[model samples]
Target chain A: MSVVSAEALRERPVEAVPEDAHDDGLAPRAKFLPSLGAVYRAQLSRARVARIPLLFVATFQSIGIMILMRGVVDQGGREAQAVVAGSAVLVVAFVALNLLAQYFGQLRAAGGLDHYATLPVPPASVVLGAAGAYASFTVPGTVVTAVVGCAMFDLPLTHLWVLAAVIPLAGAALSGLGAALGLLAPRPELATLLGQLGMSAALLLGVLPADRMPEFVQYARDLLPSTYGVEAFARTFGDHPDWATVLLDLGVCAGVGVASLAVATWAYRRAAVR
Target chain B: MCAVRGLSKTYPAARGRRGAPGTPAVRATDDVRLDIRRGEIFGLLGPNGAGKSTLVRQLTGLMRPDSGSVEILGHDIVRYPERAARILAYLGQESTALDELTVSLAAETTGRLRGLSLKDARAERDDVLEELGLTALAARPLKKLSGGQRRLACFAAALVGRRPLLVLDEPTTGMDPVARRAVWAAVDRRRAERGATVLLVTHNVIEAETVLDRVAVLDQGRVIACDSPAGLKERVAGEVRVELVWREKAPMELSEVARLRERAVESGRRWSLRLAPDEARSAVAAVTGGPAFDFLDDFTLATPSLEDVYLALGGSRSGVKGLVKA
Candidate 1:
């Protein structure tokens, strides 16, 4: 063999050698098998380490709000349940709003897309990995929100498994949407504006009771995923278990998650190739 | 081994530009073709806006060519990028280091991603850190390092993969002469010990000449010349000239010595002669033959170098006009 070809053969791993050869016995496996889980874990670890301050603030805020709500519930005033439920919905929205905004903002500002594009992993893997990091970062807030919501408002712990599933699903859905928004936004300033608009829309649909709103407003609220989240959380606090409502909410959140994830995947691929 | 054939790239024109009543595409690469042999240090020399980085990006599978094919180690970059990526290591002109991560962690992570075991990764990291003189700042975050140090760290990350092919885009930029030499030494070692192929994109001709086995010069997205450094220098027409100066005035002028030798053999007094285009041997013989030649104080011989060829071929104003005409 010529020198160039010989050098090329020497660089190949033993597994890539032909079967007829009496060379080192090794078998070739599938090539370019991307380890999505490994990439996800790395991204999660990086984000977790970088967002320490945000985590601290979320923890303290959750505790303080829980304490304040407990005191309000002790007063036993008329319409206290209504006020407590409204406050719970507002708190959930606040936590979700801040977490999503911060996560997306950081992703854009850090040039995370550029970093992932040059990796050996596929573009889909990069998108999922970044989304997974945001998902992991929201876990602490999701847990704190559910735990505090139940304890402070004297809410029942029935159907705990379903509630446990709901929190992470909600967090993932919101985070996915946020990631898509971050990808689409031209700049940080635009992202902030769009984030505020999203938060405002969510608050209007989520914190206020549909029955209290006018007919047209209630009809509009049905289009939003946040309305389903509010219904699910409120039903958990009530005496009757609304299984159908819970299923519908989970289905809608899952659909939104899937759609946003698709957007993120497309955006990531475009960014990589460009 | 990497091969790029008939590659072309055009960037979209920006908005609000009036040209022929429509926006025109900026042709970044124009039907460029080259083959990088295994275990050889090939240099791509070009000035700014010469599309060297674009070509490098295409070979490394960072970008798809608008038209043409790029195969890395027998795998087509467009059709099988993942397979190509396993054996190819790319260090872009821009620093790709995560500012928050320590230098050691960046190298370790790069190794891990390339499928190195943790123990092996750590061992390799230490070896590379020591080799690049980065041991003292291994624990420091990338943000803390100077521009040159950060570039070195990025280079170390690229080397950590231990892939068979390395594509370096301006690798020695922001490096001191000692550090640059050290990098060249490491690159040479890789080619010698592991038979690694390296594609170096650089504009610094002097530094590149030390390591490149062959060079391709690109001008405005086209390959104008491709050959070994010595071969390229030989293409330029010139003769080696030697000038000899004595402490005192010589009895005969340099031209007189040449004409007198052609006419007849004559005894000579103390004389210093400057050899013409092709007369070094006879001139040296006649000078040494006389006793006065023993007092020769200093002599210097100058020949055409790569820099001179580069200037004649690319730097001259008329050369560019000629190329355009051709």
Candidate 2:
């Protein structure tokens, strides 16, 4: 609370912008965005080295659930397709949702944001870069789960390429949710608990057959961001797939991904300055 | 060069069972102003909770001030923080490097984040690592290193950028004596070779006294004094201090020490006394010239130092926090 002279507080006139003392021009204003590729590469390297084992676990856990469901669901049925698609998407949720929440939560709790805040890069680069890195980690695991689940259920192999788009879009939405939860939680332990609960909800509401659930429960399923992604992938399994409805569902997933990541970016800025 | 004018911040108190329901918010920083000149090492000296970290955060644009502004390299940092980043390199009080990264990678990444090209960042990282004797640990992950090693890596990252301004908070906190000396040598080289302005915030007054060109002593969120080490020490020049060690076989009786009792502060086997400039010479002479001199094993005359100035100005031995009265 050092007192400023009253004159300094008044806005300077436009004409006076270049008139005062100490105006050496050696230092220029920095660009709002640094190289996004540099940030992406660094974040990706960190994720690969620190979280790959967990990614493996996510893949096997999803496949394990599918195998457990094989005994209950009849082969070559829509319910079997739902199980395969939902479990595949669940791997994305495990990393993008459960693990990312813990990462940012621990980062904030340990005062790590101060380092990034002092750098010249834009806050969005950090948000998007870390989100992208964590999402990329899910690609191999998501693909493995999807391909294995399809074979286990005797589903056709022609539509498995849908996973490429499905993984990132679904990953963005879930990772954004995870990042927000981590950044907002007061403690790291609380962030971990919230992340696990969020992943558990995705597993129960997103994977099960919609026909088996009551109408109200289905409404709740529609609210989960990953459900649209699951529905989009599940539609591709039919002998005659509805391409229009598939694109629409995928479009919803993409839209939600953008909106959720935006909120997570805002949350990052809010938490960092505190 | 950097200047902070009229900086102030207030943090809202948490509302819960432990909160005093109607108490006012905590004022972490009160109207504070400071100037760090070009190519000079300026020290911000204070006990804990004196707003040192808060002031540095404002200067580095890590936090927004509720009022006032910081101008760096002739640009107002509050309005153009990115420009500040272009000129200023900061090492925060907390260790902020990514734990999963190797030391060299962390340094290079930090340099890149500050706008260096990959090639230049790598070269700078190599030179700094060799200079700090951290080359041996270049490939080690941060979490695997000892506490001192991690601190050295953080210091290396801050030093390699070669910006015009450097802001370091407790940069030598966990370092050993040799490492501490090495870090100071690096800082000296930066100022001497590059003419960089350094804003060093630390509680290690003794070590900083040897390198600081000027220092501001903060207490209870306000600056109590600002001057060169010599100038600050001169404030108490009228008095002299003497260290005494008494002979175990010939301890003097209290009656014989009556003449020096009032002005003395004693602890254990040593006694310190303050005397007017004219009286000091005679006092030292009397203590050593008298018959009771046989009771003293050793005594040495000394001038007041920056440590004395800090203690005298802070008014307390502990780094306790409270509001300073206007």
Candidate 3:
């Protein structure tokens, strides 16, 4: 017996696939947007049962923080504005950053990347779809907290629509960071721990008033992407919001989102190969 | 429609905990070459650590080989790695991540990801579910099902929106006899109707011998034999494996036992001897005749199987060279 060479093996009259030899004619390569939508829907359905209760917990926790902070700050003052803004964005950080990290971490440790890699879908679609699904869970939580905080603090509701910008931008940045942490951690337990620590950082830094903080702590606050979301939402509570400053804060959030997501995509590709 | 030539991959050494030294690197696959024909059901067979799984990953472009090339459907998968998902539906042994999804959703979602239109994806998902006799279990989450049922669901997911090549590793593992037949029937129907080629990696030699058109037996990251089941069995032709079990006591000074024991492989109370057909008959008679029956629990004489070929080719050894091709 001998090893069969390519030409020698082709001596037989068999034909396997008869489609365009140069193309993936069996099924068209999945377009990015459509496939991303499909992944989002699937991930959303799969995660709904598990994340719904957590979403409630997240919303309730943010609301409780505002109630506690009201005792320490003057109503209708700048400190009150910081507390309300930080509490709202904290919802986004809780779901998008914390839960998303645990999800991808478990997926990686359990060899779930192999399943997605085998699919014809683009790798970016997988990361984005999951990020979108987890972030979507934060929408209602963030809104309910913001509305409740404004009422409790006697803040005007005229600029509540700014939440539209806050949730997605902050969610993207946090989701990307969460995803990267999960995929990079060698173990799922470590990923979960890291996610909890991240949510803690958002709580301690984002929800706290910056004026009383030590100078170094304020610098640390600036490093957290969710803090910028806090800043943007807090500025909107003024008598006349500075539109340019709000836009600048959002632009920074969006930039961090893209950079972090790119890092996550790179992490996913690296993990999938092994 | 799959071609692999001179593929090799070596893992880098792991750094030590103290950063002073490292564990040795592992060469998972050597310079391996194989060509699977169109519409063929090919099997990769080997003992544990023989690198069958690594080769399968490289062939599907999930893992990059250090050197060499892989082509599926005439496209260079080595250069355009993502093309593998288009050319083949890879069903790996690991399907735990899909455990959260219901059987129906898993199948339908896979079809959608394969670029099927929503309506077509649903229709095909339903068809595959029905064909696999899983319509009743379609709504059940995979984690709630039996291991065998989960494996069947994974198969259904892979089968939906068919690709030209199906790379299935251990597809029938954990399956009950009935489910295994259903899987093979579905695979056979696809091959006959749509001309799909199948590349299977399995440790189940009986299944391989029963269904595979060809097999490649690997040892130490290299293929030592590639041939049809019957062709490979010829490596141990004219030999019968006589297995004997003894009761509480051993046979004392039986001439046949003494002669066979010298060349026999023993595990616990059972002994397996490679013998000629006539020698096997004589040995069986000796073990069951007279007072020898008191010591003999049971015995069997069998023809050579694909497993014997694997053993003969040293599939469990450190390394084996020479390709026994068909």
- Highest DockQ scorer: 3
- In order of TM-score, best first, we have 3, 2, 1
- Candidate number with greatest TM-score: 3
The alpha-carbon deviation from the true structure for residue B312 of candidate 1, after best TM-score superposition, in angstroms, is: 3.0
Model 3 spans > 4 angstroms off? A1-27, B15-23, B249-259, B290-292, B317-326
**Cand. 1: chain B TM-score:** 0.74
* Residue B288 miss distance in model 3 (angstroms): 3.1
Ranking of candidates on DockQ, top first: 3, 2, 1
TM-score, candidate 2, is 0.84
Docking class of 1: incorrect
Query: Model 2, A1-274: lDDT tens per residue?
Result: 1122335334422232222122463333223355455566777877776788898889988999999999999877899988999999999899999998998899888888888777776777777778788888888888888888888999998998888888888988898889889988999999999999989988998888889899999998999999988998998999999989988988988898898788888888888775
TM-score of chain A of 2: 0.88
What proportion of the real contacts between chains A and B does each prediction keep?
0.08, 0.35, 0.47
| Every candidate's TM-score, chain A alone | 0.70, 0.88, 0.91
TM-score of each: 0.70, 0.84, 0.90
Selected candidate, larger DockQ, 1 vs 3: 3
lDDT of 1 by residue, A1-274 (tens): 0222445446743343223222221112112323355455555655555666766565555456556646544423222333333333333334444445544555555454434455565555555655656566656664556556566556665644564556555555665666666666767666666666765666566544455689888888777655655566556555766788878877887787777778867765665555
